[model samples]
Target: MNKLAWVLVSISFVVGSSAHAQKEIPKAEGYDQCPLGYINTLGTKCVSPIYYEVEPTYGEACESGWMNIGAGYCKKKTILGIF
Candidate 1:
């Protein structure tokens, strides 16, 4: 009987803890709102935008030995030779 009661208590505690953890906290005022493709810095809490090189347009001429992969970018082709 005591073991059954303990099991019930343990299950309830696990469920309650999980529910509490899933709750979202409201953002406080004066907090920086990070833009798209940006992330908040850990220490300073500043917004750091991520940047990437501009990809070439599709159907455009690619450099020699490179082929367009249809994702606005070109990739170098690999040639396999017998060892």
Candidate 2:
């Protein structure tokens, strides 16, 4: 009886956890499903490649170790240091 109860409890726990797992996201209206890390807002639009703000240089030259990206902005230059 003890073994049977434990088995049933374990089964219920597994099923319950699975049931609470995230469901498939529906496709955006008139578009395919959104890529990972992207989300569909308002059920009618899928925003991808989200936008971000970049700090402006305000007419100053790019700081050392940074490269000028034009338009008064600078972007950090990556150094691979690979031989």
Candidate 3:
């Protein structure tokens, strides 16, 4: 019957759309990278001469790690989705 066909069509539409619905990757809930030479610390950016000091602040989700942006500092939340 037309009613059955309509129900089937609706179900198919829902299932088809679900397949295309991509899930977003998880992201760190904190600041990434640093303010150039400055390193992120205690949820704040700071200046550091050594590279190691800045790596941890970016978290491990980054593709490689936070890079020295420009001016103050910045970090991309979803770099490459390694996780």
- The number of the candidate with the highest lDDT is 2
What is candidate 3's lDDT per residue for 33-70, written digit by digit as tens? 44444544545345455332222334324234444344
Candidate 1 Cα deviation (angstroms), residue 10 = 0.4
Model 3 Cα displacement at 50 (Å)? 44
Flag regions of model 1 displaced more than 4 Å: 23-83
lDDT of every predicted structure (CA atoms): 0.40, 0.46, 0.41
Top TM-score prediction, candidate number: 2
Better of 1 and 2 by lDDT: 2
CA shift at 24, candidate 3, in angstroms?
5.8
How many pairs of residues collide in each model?
0, 0, 5
Candidate 2, 72: how far from true, in Å?
1.6
Candidate 3 segments exceeding 4 Å error: 28-83
Model 3 Cα shift for residue 13 (angstroms): 0.1
lDDT of 1 by residue, 1-83 (tens): 99999999988965654442211122223434422223445433322232222224445776776555333344344333110
Give the TM-score of each candidate. Answer: 0.27, 0.31, 0.30
RMSD of 3: 14.3
Comparing 1 and 3 on TM-score, the stronger one: 3
Rank by lDDT, descending?
A: 2, 3, 1
Q: Residue 73 in candidate 2 has what lDDT?
A: 39
Candidate 1: RMSD over Cα atoms? 19.5
